[model samples]
Target chain A: MAEAENKQVIFKQYIEGVPKETDMEIKVSKTELKAPKGSGAILVKNLYLSCDPYMRGRMRDFRGSYIPPFVPGQVIEGFGVSEVVHSDNPNFKPRELITGLTGWEEYSLIQKTEQLRKIQQDGIPLSYHVGLLGMPGFTAYAGLYEVCSPCKDEYVFISAASGAVGQLVGQLAKLHGCYVVGSAGSNQKVDLLKNMLGFDEAFNYKEELDLDAVLKRYFPQGIDIYFDNVGGDMLDAALLNMRIHGRIAVCGMVSQQNLSDAKGIHNLFNLITRRVKMQGFLQSDHLDLYPRFLEDVTGYYKQGKIVYVEDMNEGLESAPAAFIGLFSGKNVGKQVIRVARE
Target chain B: MAEAENKQVIFKQYIEGVPKETDMEIKVSKTELKAPKGSGAILVKNLYLSCDPYMRGRMRDFRGSYIPPFVPGQVIEGFGVSEVVHSDNPNFKPRELITGLTGWEEYSLIQKTEQLRKIQQDGIPLSYHVGLLGMPGFTAYAGLYEVCSPCKDEYVFISAASGAVGQLVGQLAKLHGCYVVGSAGSNQKVDLLKNMLGFDEAFNYKEELDLDAVLKRYFPQGIDIYFDNVGGDMLDAALLNMRIHGRIAVCGMVSQQNLSDAKGIHNLFNLITRRVKMQGFLQSDHLDLYPRFLEDVTGYYKQGKIVYVEDMNEGLESAPAAFIGLFSGKNVGKQVIRVARE
Candidate 1:
């Protein structure tokens, strides 16, 4: 049998500020279809790759960070849905469908079998595992129910409202009987959040003359829970507008991601005055809640209470542009790259 | 009986940016040595007054702040150690030493006697009640033990390390066997923190051209607990140097209190990457721990394990300058005004 040519997205170097598509390179390598002898390894063909805001952190050579930086001249790793072609593991056999951490390539020989989760549930698309049923969905779930501990009838505000996690956070808060509002960069995204995503109110942050004033208008009583996806001026404004005992789940700082120097949050004193709690959380920390999250979100999806919008790009060649597009808000929803058809 | 003359510090107007001595006025008024008729009030002669950083928030007319702004032309209120001269309440007697919220004046007729705490222990200076044994002390205790949940052998960093609360946080962290470092404004304060205060390491932040480099030098292993008293750039640097799962107690932002436009803090992305938790807390929220705190801190003081420094001013006339000096780092230790002899 002959080795197959593997097309992989390789990170060229550590990025300085905003990552351009040129920062990554597509390198064609060759891999065998069989797992190595005397190993619990599984070889899979990558079907879909997830492009998350968190990936930007991996591009920087930052020490003491949660995840390690991707090595230059290596295949960039991310969450992806894959189809098993060869297996030496008892848990996952050949032709089994799974989703977990994998390389952004045509094929990956996963050595750690425990890291890959078997996607056995029916009535769902495999790509949905990356967007609604995987990391982003679980992030929204854990951050809201565990971190925020939100109550009914409370006012909730979400930043980056049109993104994967924000869309779900808004929907979950609405289902909880809370008044939810979101802010996005574009008018189209604002419309998607309000009309398509079921937010009580949505505003284009770029269009607003003052974000603080816009938040004040939407939340007359003040925000009870702010699912902060963009952490610069939005976090500052949210700090000032937080109600007593308000909770801010620091999801991401996409707005400050590419800056050489981050924007300062001046209104942090309000945290003391209002007795608010602002905390940063990562989805990887709440892996224990994965089972419950999948069940609850799956029910919501079946009942038509949840819908995920995916911006799909065909082929591994498009992966660089798709990942780079995340910082610029060029993708409409959960950005995913299709490495192969299911 | 002839009425006694009472001098008071009155807030002249709400401050726009940095507060000046002229923002407050010393006014002479008259008070009888008795409570009003049918009023269950106690009359107290103010012995010592405290100048704390939180008072700056009250000077601004900004709405949605933690506490209401002080009404212009009214007497400014703050913590003070006082001697009761006349008491109509059954709980308090004449000459009973007490400490709590009091007007910055020669005497105050306290109508709400319930808000005051009777001074029980002796051998410690009653003036200590306003600093080491008062709100600042309790703030340090609650913020460290409760909010941060610091562990032994962990690295701890305290900003504004020579002030009332910051001083105690460093001492307590040292007692816990943690590697402690503090940042102060001047070389003298830095010396005080190292020589007198017993901090393992201390640095003059103003002299350091790069705060991040300074922190990296001090905390080579990275900070596990950051007691954030100065929230702008110091916080930004600390975030970069925080170890995994670090907790930041947002005690105060004395550096940012006077700015018209506060310095934007970048590098919050580290919070997610490092799984850090940054929370702001108020001393008032933890009053339930006062009795235990009094016992523990008093024991530390008796054992010579704890000591507090006081920067005492002569009279009510010095209160304005002392309060204004907090932003400029003029006064050393806990800024106290000795209105009269105990």
Candidate 2:
């Protein structure tokens, strides 16, 4: 059989501070489209790629991290939406839409068929699998419900409120009858949180001189639940304004990712005074809840009760810029890359 | 009837830095023992008083706290083991032994009986109700079991390990087959943690110049659970060396109490990277589990499976020093004042 060509983005080296375009490079290679006889594997054509802040942590050689470091000169693996072009495994067939850990390339040969899930829904945009309807959406759902445990009429505060997970968390809290508030880095993002996402109040942390003062002014009675995305100074400020028995669900710490010396939090004593419960979690840890998450979120989307925002980079070359924008708070909501359209 | 005389200790004023002996003074006053006809109340002779670090937070006029502030020239109230000398409420009878909120001096007239529990077990010393068998004991129990959820053979680290609550937590984790280690402030207390409490390892944090290095040496596999009594730097160090999904039960932060500018925790980014869960709680919040706790702890004590240590000061006059010792890490174990021991 003749070899088929594959187009891919390869990691040039480990990233430092803000990732530059030079950190990653596009490369083309040739591979057999069909798996060898007796080999159980499936070949896929990549449709969508997820651009997440957590990818930054994988770019560094950090000890005691959940995921392994992305090796230099390798295609970065992340959640992606794909179409099965050829399959040796019975579970996946030709033309079947699927989602799982896939490469940042035009084609991938996945040997572990069990790792990928066959997509049952057909009408929704395939790119949604990388954003609002995928890991970020489930993370927001699980963190808000399982960790934060919001109650009716409770005051909810979310940091990085205009980002993928944060936007979904704010909306979910609102659906649960909570009075939602959010903090974004830029004025444009703050406006998006309040106007587009229906947050009761939203603030631009950059514009707010004092975070503690801002929280106090926004939540006079104090916050009941806090969905933390940007850790560091924002987390310290949220600690001071939490009510007794308040819950803090830590989803991400995008702000402290690149700093050689992480910021110090001074107000932790408030944890004891306020009797707060601060819990950190990853979406992969709660995969059991995904089925329920998909059913509820899809229902919300179809009913028009939920709104999802995305900043879609047009091609594989723009993927690097889209991923880097997460640190500077450039993207308004879920950041995704449109590698190809089925 | 002639006015009844009452002897009590009153806070002279709000204190600064380490509380001094002169900051509080014992005063003799008169009060009617009878609850003016329709008032349901009980008069009791105080027997044992609990000197906890949480009281120090209340001593200040902090904006948000679980308990109310101590008013100037008023009796300080905390968990005490007492005998009812007189009673008008149906729940209490004269000569009944009870454990509840009581005055710092020799006598108290309690208006609320809801928070009080009748002491049924007479095999142990009645004074145990103020320490190992009471609120402090339950605080350690719930914080370790329910909050920490320690696994068998996991590395367990406890701060203030020789203190009342820490002593019980270490013993309980040992009973659950965990590899328990603790940090005390002095050589004598460190010896007690290893010898008396049966910890796998004990270190004098004061003697160790590099706490992080010390922790890494002791917990080579990393800490699975940290029972945090002294926060600030110790907590920061623990955060750096925590295993994935490690649990931190934030019962208190004694090290940061006296400082006007508390030390900042710089390694909290570990919460996200390691997916650690840190929660702060009050003993009163878990009152519903009191019966289960009482049964379990009492069974453990009777079976010789658990041991507790106490530093007893003789009179109410010594209460101030005993409490002050808590901030300085002077007391070896649970600090209790024996006002009128049986």
Candidate 3:
């Protein structure tokens, strides 16, 4: 078989502060559509790429982290939807669609077949595999349902509400009869949260000077479940506003990730005073729930009980800007890149 | 009957900074050796008063805390061992020894018999009822076994190791066949922890400037269970050295209590990265466990498996100084005042 040009996004080096677009570069390489002999691996043609906030952590030189730091001069990997171009694995074949952690390139030779989940296309968009039905979606699902364990009519406050995970959390809690309130960076995101995502209340956190006052204003009855994504002053405020036996599900701390030194959290005293249960969790820990999560989230999407908003940047070269845009809240929804059109 | 003079410790006013001897005053008041008709109350001659670190939080003007702040000019209330001088209630009678929430005075007119527990003197020192057999002991017990749910062979680290709760936690973890390390405020306390309390290793946290480095040295292997008593830099350091699925029971934060603005905790990122569960708890939440805890601890005490150290200050007039000594780590062990020696 003749070689084809493989366009790849490569990490130049580890980052110290807020990552810039210059930190990543697009490199063109040659690839033959083949898997190694005696290797039970498949070659995949990348379709959709996911740009997530967690990727920033992998860019750091930190040794002890949940995910290992991305090696310099290597193609960064993330949750991507792909099609089998060639296969040596018995379980997969050419043109079979799957979703898993794949390289930031036009093509990849996947070695771990166990990591790939054969795509179940029930008239759903393939891009959704890296989003509402993917890691971010499952994170929202398990963190809220399992970790927070929301009760009906309880007050639910979510930070970073317009992000991939936060948007879904608000919708899920709202559907469960919770009085859902969300905080976003922009007025548009806040509007989308309240008007489109069906959140009972939404606010632009940037506009609010005092987070504690804002929380007290919206949640006069006190917050019962806090889906913490921003995790700084919002967490402090949430701690103060939590009712007795309230739960704080620590999903992500996007607010603190960019700074060289994380901001100190001061209102932890409320954790004891309110008997609040603050649990930090990863969706990977709840893998046993994925099959059910996929099924439930799929049903919600089809019945229009849940709606996903995705911001798409076209082509492989747009990858760097799309990824960097996440930190600044530049993207409106689940930030996705259309790597190629089948 | 002739009324006796009552030497009572009264709260002068709410304190913003660390409480001092002057914050409380010894006032002489008249007390009759009688109970009012149909009052359904009991009059107790206070014997021993327990000085706990949690009282510092009560000194603040902050409302909505676990326990309400002490009213100005009222006798400060705490766990105390006493002899019932007179009773109008059927449950308690004159000369009945008991331990309950009582005022820091030579004599107390207790209105609620429901709050009192009739002391079961099993040759155990009456002082133990306010320390190992009282709120602090139960706080350590319920927080570790119930909240942490620690397994055998795990690595446990307890802060404020020589304090009333920490000393017991270290011993309990040792009995459970776990490797335990403890941190104290002074060299003398550290020696007591290793030599007398049977801790595997103990360090004076004040001597070490880098808390994270000190924790890393003691726990070369990551910490599995951290009973956090001093919750400023120590809690921050514990977060950095926590193993996956580790548990941190937030028992107290005496380090942060005195400061008007609590020191910011910065290493909470480790919570998500390590999948650590940090729970803040109260002893009152586990009142049902009191009977079981008392039996188990008493057994451990008798078998010489557990030993408690008491730091007793003679006379009711010394109550203010003894209580003030706790914040400075001046007391050797469970600080108690001998209101009227048995």
Candidate 3 per-residue C-alpha lDDT over A131-192 given as tens digits, one digit per residue, 9 for 90 to 100: 99999999999999988999899999999998999999999998899999999999999989
TM-score of chain B of each: 0.98, 0.96, 0.98
True contacts kept of each: 0.75, 0.71, 0.63
- Off-target runs (Cα >4 Å) in candidate 1 are A27-29
Evaluate residue B106 in candidate 2 and report its C-alpha lDDT on the 0 to 100 scale: 79
Q: Estimate each model's TM-score.
A: 0.96, 0.93, 0.99
Of 1 and 2, the candidate ahead on TM-score is: 1
Q: Pick the candidate with the highest lDDT.
A: 3
lDDT of model 2, residue B337 = 89
Regions more than 4 Å wrong, model 3? none
Interface RMSD of each: 1.6, 1.3, 1.0
As for candidate 2, its clashing pairs are B164-B334
Deviation (Å) of B76 in candidate 3? 1.1
lDDT score at residue B8, model 1, on the 0-100 scale: 91
Positional deviation of residue A51's Cα in model 2 after best superposition, in angstroms? 0.9
Q: Candidate 1 lDDT, tens digit per residue, B1-342?
A: 348999999999988788899999999999897877668898999999999988998888876565688999999999998998988888888889999898999989998788899997579988999999899999999999988998999999999999999999999989999989999999999999999999999999999999999999999989999999988889989988998889999888888887767777777777777778888889888999999999999999999998898999998999999999998899899999999987
Stretches of candidate 2 above 4 Å error? A1-6, A28-39, A88-90, B1-7, B26-40, B83-96, B118-121
User: Per-prediction DockQ scores?
Assistant: 0.65, 0.66, 0.75
